[model samples]
Target: MADGETIARERIERLESLAREAVAADEEDRARSYVRRARRVAERHRLRLPRSFERSTCDACDTYLRYGYNARSRTQSGHVVVTCDCGAQSRYPYE
Candidate 1:
């Protein structure tokens, strides 16, 4: 992975961790902010962050798309493409 991707992923992870903590503490407002930031990070990296309110399944693998490495769609050919920071893309919308 490229330096940018690595850094972005790490930052997203931190944000997620913090978000979880905020939720556990019942700090809904702060948790929402963290979630917004996390969503921004995911968008910046073109990871197609799942909707905050949508309970959608992966269109390909049928796995529950989690945040970070958990969100992605596979091609019809069955490739485990990590849409976040893999640096090599195959089944993206453009291709």
Candidate 2:
């Protein structure tokens, strides 16, 4: 990987950690900001966000999702369904 890619990855990691901390502290807006920034860095670097991070974020509102807190999760039709507080739903297939 290039130096830029390495840097972007580091930044994304940092942002993700900060976002988690913010969410744990009940600062939704701050966590959302971190999520948005991480996405922007990934886009600018043409890098894919990690799968876990992607699934833990709301695509519509860029908010960090905490299952049972700001989001709801259920299994249906062989897929895991995640629903955000903003009424957005994401489904991922399960084995």
Of the candidates shown, which would achieve the greatest lDDT relative to the real structure? 2
TM-score of 2: 0.98
Q: Per-prediction TM-score, please?
A: 0.50, 0.98
Q: Rate the local accuracy (lDDT) of all candidates.
A: 0.54, 0.97
Off by over 4 Å in 1: 48-95
Assess candidate 2 and give its lDDT: 0.97
Instruction: Tell me how many clashing residue pairs each candidate has.
Output: 0, 0
lDDT of 2 at 15: 96
Q: Write the per-residue lDDT of candidate 2 for residues 1-95, one digit (tens) a residue.
A: 99999999999999999999999999999999999999999999999999989999999999999999999999999999999999999999999
